[model samples]
Target chain A: MSTAIALHAPIEAASRAARSAPAADAARADAMEATLRALVDAVPTATLLFDADQQVRYANPAARVLARLCAPDKADRPLAVVGDWHPELLNSGALHLCSMHGSWSGEVILGVGRGQHKILLLHLSRVGADLFGMTVRDITQDSMRESELHARNAELEVAYAKLQGAQEQVMQSEKLASIGQLAAGVAHEINNPIGYVNSNLSTLQRYISQLFSAIQSYEAALAGGAGATEAESIRRKLDLDFLVGDVPQLLSESREGIDRVCKIVRDLKDFARKERSEDWIKADIHRGLDSTLNIIWNELKYKAQIVKTFGELPPVECLPSELNQVFMNVLMNAGQAIRDQGIITVTTSVAGERVRVDIGDDGEGIPPDVLPRVFDPFFTTKPVGSGTGLGLAISYGIVSKHHGTIEVSSTPGQGTLLRIELPIAQPR
Target chain B: MYRILLVDDEPNILSALRRCLASIDVGELDGEALKVEAFTSPEQALERSEEQDFDLVVSDYRMPGMDGVEFLSAMMELQPAVPRMICSGYADRDAIIAAVNEVQLARFIGKPWVDEELAAAVVALLRPGSARARAPKALRAQAASARITRVEQDDDGAIVLRSDDPA
Candidate 1:
């Protein structure tokens, strides 16, 4: 350890002057010492003073607090243990380094609070002959705040990713909704013409059948005998019975053919009516289901037999038409799933405050991977224009509007069950 | 022979219903079974209906001259024994509810109804003692159960069996 610390010239000159005039100005020198001590104590920096012997002399209040970190048992902060710029190197390395370089400064970590380490900047410099000064600036709080900011930034990035996913779903739904509105308008406009044309066709059929009937009757009368002159002339010429019977038979068949076209139009009209909106009313779910069945019967009647097991339930408050749409979508899907012959079972029951409807089918069931995404917009197993891929998606939306839930479960080849749980009465 | 009066604004509809009833009246049986006084104009139908006796009246609900409810109500006043049938489409729900009160032997025939449905309605109107005749609309519909015939393979690759299918 160095016996003397390199001191600054001005401090040495002042010390020399104090030594020489001490006898005549001892009181003034004493007052100067008190002022310097008070200034060091007032500063927040932890500062320490060492005497010519390189031993600790004076320690301000800040220095005393820092000393407790290294020397927990000591009342006096009498030393800065510096060996290779390490606090654990409790030796006079700063004292020796200051003598050669006139100053030394570096960052170090010290034991501060019960097993806690604190970052600190330490500076050592010569102040007078054989004297040294040390200062420490604690930097623990600054670095901690910096790390917390980094963690917060990472959290924000995750939240933004989730928000983007939700936005995409909303956009898809909006696009499909606009298309539905257009379809409804087209359907409403076509209703009237279909009505009259349909009636005309049925009548036309009746006419054909009647004409056929008259011809048959005239043939029968002729087969009996061509004896009466008046009757024979009328049968050979005007053929009154033939005109009446043949016309009716032919028209009846023609009307039947026209009626087929009318049905297609009517089914299309019902599909468009999904867009028609009315206030919520207490309505029979069975009625909605039945009407939906009638509308889509052509699709199902060939592929599947229907079984209805409806429970006794009070009329549910709902938009009857909208619910009809939901039923149609589910039922049609069930029918399409069947490759050949199958059975579709529709069961409705009241559970607690909810009305539960289950439509199950013994058909080619949904794949496990596909089932989860069945209600996702634009997700479909059908090829190209065979479907719009919005059936289940729209069904989901309608159920959601009614504050209800729809879920499906299926096995690969066994069957599928779609369950709809709706509130009995929606809040007005 | 049963006498039926059929009226509609549309010429095609009047001709169609008249022919259908004419076939049913005259066909299948040995001779003409019923007489239909068919007219395109409601005013003309009203004139003819007053000049003759009709067992039943089936009229289109929507007409430029007069709605079916008003037409049926007028028929109710003139021929109290005759059943009044309205062929209505999506429209006229409110009017039907109102007309149901004034009309005797009131019957509603949904437009684009199948041959079987029209036949049943005709039989019910003529034979008042039949089970479906006195039953209310809802009950009658229930009693008219869906008839599923034997399924047959169609050329289109669908196994379909249509029995009196209007659609």
Candidate 2:
């Protein structure tokens, strides 16, 4: 992400630019040689005088310093400097072209270090027969400044991308929080009415029982036929016997319906209670799995046959509500993965100190390429609007929070198995 | 003959509790006087209980003005030995624990209770020398600071304790 360019490139249009450039006289080449040498030495630019053999004849202070940088031992010597490191300096063809042409100016890059370079401006002119005056200017500093600016721009791009990801996570949590609050409110509202209705139904049931006992007592009292005709007529007209037989069964059925509603409301409340707190508790994984399964039973009832194989496990330390959410998310995903009929088998076991839970599904298995990316946020095979794609992501976070590891292995067209191994006690 | 007081914000709920008293086996109540009084207001129930001695008090956890915890605690101040039970749909964990420790709530009946379950709880509380009559304060204090054990289900099935609620 770096950019480098020579701003004052004096060589590309040297035919016009050379008019302002400092140059040695071509007319009085022999007469002003001494004066020209002194004038060139006074210039800050590195000026080198080369003989016909490409040897260094005379170098000004700047040229001497640059020579030491590229050629250390030959700094004091007037012999020709090695061309390997500064081949561009010597290979620019300025000297060769100056012999055939009037004036030659060109730009060449010279290696300053192993991988770094300096843009040098080479100006060549014939001072006398087989002798040439050359000026070199280093322009690497400006080029490095441009490169550093570009590198910083690239770093900012990486940082912005990370910020976007973090922001998305925050928004997701907020969304869940609002939804949880709404659910809790609804659960509470439902709870009050259900409470009264449940109580009333129980009272009705008791009243029915008492009425039957009263009828039994009346029958015993009238067994002597003291008021038999009148009582029999009243009973037949009111259909008392049928009423006594049907009411209890009807009440029992209504009781069942109330139970179902209570269970649903309980689940709704649990779902609404956000597990935002960080308090860790000793939790039983098996019980959480069943409640979660019952809560989300409708989602899987039609999709797959669930098989549960549980082993003895110590109560693992965790947030029960959060774990319930994790289980529901994974279970729902498993149910949705199946297109038609499939089997989702969940098994738990104790492996020494770690409790392991494996949820395996025989459905349209994840493709090899997509299997590894399942836990990535916003990654989903479900259609748009059907899934937010954060199920596995949240699950991953919850499991990680518990100091647990979740791994998934899948065979395309066969099945996928996700194993979550958690420590019984999370390390502080 | 023993008289029990039932307090709830809902008149219908109070009436239901009155009917539930009939279903409770009288033999289990030591052939005592079967009188069930119902009240819709906690203040009135408390005020009346002060004038007349009640053998037991069954109240809903959430009520208007005063919740079951506050109402029951105030009642305990007036009559300390009366057995009390709270029936609630939901309450904060802290408040429920407080109710248990502060008022010595005899038992907690979850919402949507069946007739038989309510009757059974009443019978258990009324029986002579029953643990339900007097809550153990020391045990409640110990339980208040006890380690939290959270249980969940596994793959096979859940080990479920029989719930007093209809479910």
Candidate 2 chain B, run of 10 with poorest lDDT: B146-155
| Residue range with the least summed lDDT across 10 consecutive positions in model 2 chain A | A1-10
* Segments of candidate 1 deviating more than 4 angstroms: A1-228, A236-239, A242-271, A274-278, B1-167
Model 1, span A1-428: residue lDDT tens: 13122223334455677787856575565567557656777888876666545455655677656666555655443353332123462336656787778888876677654688777777888876666777877777766786788788788888888876664455344434433433422232233345545554665555456456656766776797655674556555544565556455545644654575576566555544533345778889987887677656644654578999999978998877777767877887898898878999999999999999999999999999999999997898988765677778878988998999999999989999999999998866
DockQ of predicted model 2:
0.13
Best by DockQ: 2
As a whole number from 0 to 100, the lDDT of residue A65 in candidate 2 is 64
Q: What is the TM-score of each candidate against the true structure?
A: 0.36, 0.43
lDDT minimum window of 10 residues, candidate 1 chain A? A1-10
Q: Give the CA lDDT, 0 to 100, for residue A348 in model 2.
A: 99
